[model samples]
Target: MGNQQSIKIFLALMLSTAYIFSFSHFGALAYNTLFKNTDAFAAGTAIGHLDISEKTAAEAERLLEEEVEKWKAKTKITFSYKEKKAEADTALYEFYIEETLRTLKQGQKNLAAVDVDQEVLEEMIYRTSISLGTVEIDTKKLAADLLIGATMLDESGYTFHLENYIPEAVRKSETISKATVNAEGSLNEIKALLKKMGTVEIPAKAQFSFLRLVEEKDIQMHHSSALSIMGTAIYQAILPTNFSIIERYISNALPSYAKLGYEAKVDEKKQMDLVFSNLNDSAYSLQLSLKGNKLEAILKGQPFLNKYSIVKKDEQSFTPKTVKQYNARLESGETQVIESGKTGLLVKMVRKIFGESGELMKTEIISEDFYAPVHKVVVHSPVEPVQVTEQAETGAEEGEEEEQETPDSTTDENVPMPVPGAHSESEDGTEVDEEDNEGDEKGTEPQTSDNTGQGTDMPAGEEK
Candidate 1:
């Protein structure tokens, strides 16, 4: 009995010693991981448990540097961070960290830093016996949580100047490509668009321009959809001589809105048309035609608005009075005569009487295929004939004509001012064209010519 008791006591003593040794070893290992070797240096104690790692502090500088590099590459700004330190438990983790970061990147573009003074206190409990090896820690979740609080700055750190982001090239391309002006549009339409842009308050304002150069050799601009072709009218800045080339140039620059189920077409003079319809039905078909000095717009059925018409007499002029007069004539079922200096237009209205509705709508100006002399008569002849003569004489004199200065060329700058919307001011803030300022001495009788004012059924606004 004595021997057995002695044996039991010895065994108990050995077990207690083993437990103490193991606990000491485990505590030392846990201490090392928590205080000296963790990423993000997360050294914080929660409840009675102190979760800490020295590895976090060691990697703090490297993490900051990495973040700085990332921001530099992605944006136009750059940043840097400085190393900061704090003890456990009593230290302020967020304030200290933020302060340290702020000092490191002071006045450095958009970079800001925060100092996190961490306060960690560790408490441990262990059995009195047994030998202990290193304790394996599960750091995956902890590391992720710590990383949430850390940030870095880099090379491309700078103040944001939003205006600079839009390059001059892009602005130029957008301005020309997505012009708001429509061809042969009415003054009302032009005014409406400009008003939408708040031009009434700030007249010179422009909307955001969107332009994209496509890889395809040719690009088609559809107004609504591709299923059918339509009309597109544009009010553009064009010289009389450039009428032919301008058409082709515009066709290439603009995009088709046809994917949305409409096509655009440019009409004679400076009008644009957009047509919308489905393959099976003409019943719900509609045409949107734009015209006038301010590029006003109108809509009509396939062949409904063809007979009665109000057309522009000149390519480079915007006459609001003329447009209003045209509208009035169409309403009264009267034949109106529009005389602009020497340009004479005889507008005949074809009244429509639908059912018992007394006088139905007269006509909608679908496309104005009208061209007339700039002056009713020049001292000797019409404007076109005179231009033809000038060309012929120039062809004959070729080299000699290049050196000769005609009276027309010398006093061209002395012409009277032009009406608004009809002509813009020249560089010297003056209207400088005599052809627009014809007098009684130029011609008395109106020139005779075949008017192309007759409306034709053009395919909806599909640009060819």
Candidate 2:
């Protein structure tokens, strides 16, 4: 009985062990199949704001396409310039879907768990998705198309014109400031250009360009020099004669009334321009004219400010010093004046604003202008006067010696001999022939007949 009981116990123990082994093997196979066949995300799989988990590649692509299409439809781009406006559809912009998919695939490869640690796996599951990149616009092509449209609009005269809206009843405001500068010399050419410039009506709050107002064709440029003689000193001033006159006239004309205006120097090569803004609310007309020797620029508009005054203070004066230069072209002991000395000026220009009741409102410094001084130059020749005098004396002595060596009469066969009794003394102490004297007095041919009325070959003073 004891032996049978021990055999049963042994058989039960073996069966229990086999059952446990079979169950463990089946559980491991099922777990591996779940990881391989399920469509759920492995770990750390994301793209932008998209939840791509538990989705096939085809499903994710479809969702992303739909989302991008909606975004493109809603997006609108517009460009504006003044009153002109342009619009462009977002569909014209290029978007890269394949490139985005490739990036997402790369992110997926990084999440593979072949040799990943527990910490790494946790990080991958919690990390944010990668970007799908941005849509790109063909800006060069867009600009070309927009430019064509803008050109068409301009040709159609759709652009705004400022001249049609000028306000009437323009009145002269208080003389903000009056600048009286004598035109250095005769500015006839500049006066002609100013006359051609006519009058320009500037719109309210508009800016003005001086170069544009006056074209190169309007002014005739001539080669001229600025010559000034002060006492015994003479100055040959070199400057851009054509542009200098224009610059000086404009410089004197502008910023007279208001201190807030700007000054610009235009350069064609450098692509720079001169511009000034009219800060007043009413339209202003600028008229330039030449009165006598003065260049006058008048600003006409309704008075924006009640009273304005400009104060100019002398800051410093620079006196030119005399400089001596040696000249090889001049004779010795001779001095030529090249330039007359000029004084430089540093002047502070200030604008004073006053209230209607005669109270000063404010004083502002407009500019600190500096005028460069021209130095006095005296040119002296190095050649000595004694050397020139000696040369003249030597030349005179050589001429006298040559004259003494030459004979008064020629002995050559071709030379004609002097006729006897052909010479006669005139009242003026000059030697003259009788025939020539008679011809001169009567203004006719001399007669050949003598007292005997016989034609003879003897000379005029000889009696036949």
Candidate 3:
């Protein structure tokens, strides 16, 4: 019994020692993974506005060097609003791209330090703002955008709208696209509601929903016409931007306040909506203005690399059909024009994108719409009543006979906006599930951001 007890104590002591050793060894391994030796960045990680996920230290260094070289080649950023204009060259300021990559740590976020000449930019901003009758300038925000844009290696443009400087942050950035529609409406009740909506900001890779806006605003049902006109203006504004129109529809009849082939009809009860997604790498602001005889919708953001032109073409008109009617009191074989007919029409809307040097980059058809015409109906008295029998005459006298009616095969065919693999629904037709979550139709993907006020965290390494 004594020997057995001693053996049991020895086994227990060995098990405790093994347990402690194993715990210490694996704990150190876990610590290395979380803090020290893990060699890859977390997914969706960015280093100084540069996405360097899954990149080793060497790889990130190479990427940062390449970006710096590209930026050195194209680092000009222009600014303009209305008549005020200014230009900036980031290369002259020399943002710290090399310093950013030098401190890259294994498995961590690294934000780059961008150096911008704020004093000179402030002078330009002041001049531009004063010219526009504004005195305030947000030099920090402008500098940030400029720095980030510099790292992006593209020559873009921005606006000096004070709205973004205000406490409310109006969210107007660069002026990407704008469109104006000369329209006047009598919906006075909705003017206040519309005015309450000062300015709308669409975030990067976000969508603008018309019906959802109205519903959130708690607009009354009677203001649908005003909403539709507003929606039309928004659609027109988006037409010239890089933004993608997802679900736009036209009414069966054209609207009086909207331009032909440019109408976007929204019906809450019918579940029709006008939705567009901001497809760029930046956020955008949309402003609606109501002047004496003008209703304008302007989409403001960083200047798009290309310009867009909305064109209407290929208009084909069809002759209206004429039908005859028989009247007993009229003279035989006499035909009267009961109703004047109108011609049917179909139009194609195309969007043409042009380069900065005025060269055509691409041309895409937005939609094709066909409007039906009113048929011409005529009344006629025929002289072919000689074949009628006495029974038929008696039945006609007893009001039992019916008159023959004319046949019609005319139809209106409207083709909607085409999407990835198929076409969208026509006028007041079925719904296509194309909201373009990423604007992929235009090779656009949603840009993921950490939203860190600064570009990203600084990387760490042995060199640090």
Candidate 4:
């Protein structure tokens, strides 16, 4: 009898162990399933985190019914859910789902009329499901996890790759929006969604080119005989395009090429520095350092520029010598072959000033004939003194007599005066200015004059 009891006890222990193992396995599977189902529901129905009142939940359901009827829609399946309660450990919800379908003969009458297109049925199903909220998802962890996963997968998995490849294009393309999912059910339901997102091609054979330069003044100030750079770039697949060479040089360029990036400095030299990178089928970088009056260009970390061929082209004034002419091929009945004038801040001002007058000049070609005489400009500049003097004499100086009788006033030097052509620097050392000076010369300080206190010695045919 003791032996028998011992065997029974052993058997009981084995059964208990198996039961616990089985329960654990089931629990794990259920946990995973909850997330999977929520994901499917999210993809199929667009009912997202909803802050709905008891009244709104009912109203949404009613609205769905009305919308379905408006489409003259006949459905075999219809369902909805609502948030019964919001709880921390558990989420309570109520749901209702039903389907009715019938295959009717040409002459036979069917009670459950659901003979419809698959797409239409799918859409109706999705819309109806979207009307329900927390009624579908009860568990908090499951709901939260599914949302987090979907977001991660969508952003990292779906978008990251595309963005790395063709950033601008991919961002502009259409993707699976929440509203689209809610209305259409699934990604497959919307046939054109993926196609609309588009594709980017990376070419195997691509070439990248970049330009770099340093002024002669910079080289003289730094006391460097010459300037140079050296580096490397690679592409596994397609090449990069019009990259911001000046922007990404420090962060992306040097690291890609495995080169030591130095914070370049000029101790006694007055200089300018720039760095930028670009990638297309290939990657390219540009580094420019100016010292004294000399300029140098650096590629990677080695100099790849013709230092002897360095040129300084002023933006404010076009070089008539460098202007290239193309042979004009005239077409039959094509009489007008007007050449366009160069664009600049001053050009627009000329347009506005001339436009105000009845005799507007033809802006196609800007020559000496197109402008007013230089004396006219001088007249306008010295108008302030003449205007003030005339006003003082013409007006009945009532305030002047009262002030003379009572007291005197003094000028305040503390008042702020406008600093002409100056720019303010931000926290990051970026300069900001509102005046459009795209084609203006740099470092041209105002000069003192014989008569006037100070005036800019404007470049011939250029504006101040």
| Counted clashes in each candidate structure | 110, 2, 8, 36
Instruction: Evaluate residue 410 in candidate 1 and report its C-alpha lDDT on the 0 to 100 scale.
Output: 16
TM-score of each: 0.25, 0.34, 0.47, 0.19
lDDT of 4 by residue, 85-199 (tens): 1111101111121221112122222122122233432343334333222123223333333233222112221111111222333223221111000111222312232133222
- lDDT (CA) per prediction: 0.27, 0.40, 0.60, 0.25
Query: In order, what is each prediction's RMSD in angstroms?
Result: 26.7, 29.9, 20.5, 27.3
Better of 2 and 4 by TM-score: 2
Report the C-alpha lDDT of model 1 over 165-275, residue by residue, as the tens digit: 223443221111111233332344333333332211101111111111111212233322211121222222111101111111112112333211011334322232221
Instruction: Please write out the lDDT profile of model 2 over residues 204-289, one tens digit for every residue.
Output: 65665544554533533342111001000100010100001112111221222122122222333332333445544456555555
- What stretches of model 2 exceed 4 Å from their correct place? 1-196, 215-274, 327-334, 380-464
For candidate 3, write residues 163-266 as lDDT tens digits.
44444344346665666665566446346656666677788758878888877777766646767777788887778776776777665545578776777777
Candidate 4: Cα lDDT at 291: 29
The clash tally of candidate 4 reads: 36
Off by over 4 Å in 3: 1-185, 189-193, 329-338, 383-464
What residue pairs clash in candidate 3, if any at all?
103-459, 105-460, 110-457, 111-456, 111-457, 111-458, 174-301, 325-380
Query: Which candidate achieves the best lDDT against the true structure?
Result: 3
Give the top-scoring candidate (TM-score): 3
